[model samples]
Target: MIILGAVLLIAGFFLGITLLTTAGFVVLIIGAVLMLMGRSGRSVGGRRHYY
Candidate 1:
Protein backbone atom coordinates (compact mmCIF):
# COMPACT_ATOMS: atom_id res chain seq x y z
CA MET A 1 0.00 0.00 0.00
CA ILE A 2 2.81 2.39 0.88
CA ILE A 3 4.63 1.50 -2.32
CA LEU A 4 1.48 2.14 -4.32
CA GLY A 5 0.97 5.45 -2.54
CA ALA A 6 4.56 6.47 -3.28
CA VAL A 7 4.18 5.62 -6.93
CA LEU A 8 0.99 7.62 -7.13
CA LEU A 9 2.63 10.54 -5.36
CA ILE A 10 5.53 10.56 -7.79
CA ALA A 11 3.25 10.33 -10.75
CA GLY A 12 1.00 13.05 -9.39
CA PHE A 13 3.99 15.33 -8.85
CA PHE A 14 5.09 14.90 -12.45
CA LEU A 15 1.58 15.21 -13.85
CA GLY A 16 0.48 18.12 -11.64
CA ILE A 17 -2.69 16.40 -10.48
CA THR A 18 -3.67 18.05 -7.23
CA LEU A 19 -6.41 15.55 -6.40
CA LEU A 20 -4.21 12.56 -7.05
CA THR A 21 -1.44 14.09 -4.97
CA THR A 22 -3.81 14.63 -2.07
CA ALA A 23 -5.19 11.12 -2.35
CA GLY A 24 -1.66 9.74 -2.47
CA PHE A 25 -0.81 11.57 0.74
CA VAL A 26 -3.95 10.20 2.36
CA VAL A 27 -2.99 6.67 1.34
CA LEU A 28 0.50 7.20 2.64
CA ILE A 29 -0.88 8.12 6.04
CA ILE A 30 -3.12 5.07 6.08
CA GLY A 31 -0.19 2.85 5.13
CA ALA A 32 1.94 4.39 7.85
CA VAL A 33 -0.75 3.71 10.43
CA LEU A 34 -1.11 0.12 9.31
CA MET A 35 2.65 -0.32 9.44
CA LEU A 36 2.85 1.15 12.91
CA MET A 37 0.02 -1.03 14.17
CA GLY A 38 1.62 -4.09 12.68
CA ARG A 39 4.90 -3.30 14.37
CA SER A 40 3.32 -2.82 17.78
CA GLY A 41 2.49 -6.53 18.22
CA ARG A 42 -1.20 -5.82 17.95
CA SER A 43 -1.97 -6.74 14.36
CA VAL A 44 -4.74 -9.23 13.73
CA GLY A 45 -2.85 -12.01 11.94
CA GLY A 46 0.25 -12.37 14.05
CA ARG A 47 3.02 -10.59 15.89
CA ARG A 48 5.32 -8.71 13.54
CA HIS A 49 8.39 -6.57 13.74
CA TYR A 50 9.29 -3.39 11.90
CA TYR A 51 12.87 -2.61 11.10
Candidate 2:
Protein backbone atom coordinates (compact mmCIF):
# COMPACT_ATOMS: atom_id res chain seq x y z
CA MET A 1 0.00 0.00 0.00
CA ILE A 2 2.74 2.43 0.93
CA ILE A 3 4.80 1.50 -2.10
CA LEU A 4 1.82 1.93 -4.41
CA GLY A 5 1.01 5.31 -2.87
CA ALA A 6 4.57 6.50 -3.37
CA VAL A 7 4.51 5.37 -6.97
CA LEU A 8 1.24 7.19 -7.60
CA LEU A 9 2.61 10.33 -5.92
CA ILE A 10 5.72 10.39 -8.09
CA ALA A 11 3.79 9.58 -11.20
CA GLY A 12 1.36 12.38 -10.44
CA PHE A 13 4.14 14.97 -10.21
CA PHE A 14 5.91 13.87 -13.35
CA LEU A 15 2.80 13.30 -15.42
CA GLY A 16 1.25 16.65 -14.37
CA ILE A 17 -2.17 15.11 -14.02
CA THR A 18 -4.37 16.95 -11.56
CA LEU A 19 -6.67 14.02 -10.90
CA LEU A 20 -3.80 11.66 -10.33
CA THR A 21 -2.16 14.19 -8.08
CA THR A 22 -5.27 14.44 -5.92
CA ALA A 23 -5.77 10.71 -5.84
CA GLY A 24 -2.12 10.18 -5.04
CA PHE A 25 -2.24 12.59 -2.12
CA VAL A 26 -5.31 10.83 -0.75
CA VAL A 27 -3.73 7.40 -1.18
CA LEU A 28 -0.49 8.54 0.37
CA ILE A 29 -2.27 9.86 3.47
CA ILE A 30 -4.30 6.68 3.75
CA GLY A 31 -1.19 4.54 3.43
CA ALA A 32 0.56 6.51 6.11
CA VAL A 33 -2.39 6.13 8.43
CA LEU A 34 -2.61 2.41 7.74
CA MET A 35 1.09 2.01 8.35
CA LEU A 36 0.77 3.71 11.69
CA MET A 37 -2.21 1.59 12.59
CA GLY A 38 -0.38 -1.57 11.57
CA ARG A 39 2.68 -0.64 13.54
CA SER A 40 0.46 -0.22 16.56
CA GLY A 41 -0.87 -3.74 16.00
CA ARG A 42 -4.39 -2.62 15.44
CA SER A 43 -7.04 -4.15 13.18
CA VAL A 44 -8.26 -2.08 10.29
CA GLY A 45 -11.03 -2.64 7.72
CA GLY A 46 -11.63 -6.21 8.94
CA ARG A 47 -11.02 -8.77 11.67
CA ARG A 48 -7.50 -9.50 10.45
CA HIS A 49 -4.97 -7.47 12.39
CA TYR A 50 -2.40 -5.39 10.55
CA TYR A 51 1.16 -6.56 10.77
Q: Residue 17 of candidate 1: its Cα lDDT?
A: 100
Model 2: what TM-score?
A: 0.76
lDDT of each: 0.79, 0.78
Q: How large is the C-alpha RMSD of every model relative to the true structure?
A: 2.8, 1.9
Q: Candidate 1 lDDT, tens digit per residue, 1-51?
A: 788788889889999999889889888888888788887776544547432
Off by over 4 Å in 1: 44-51
- By TM-score, how accurate is candidate 1? 0.80
Which regions of candidate 2 deviate over 4 angstroms? 47-51
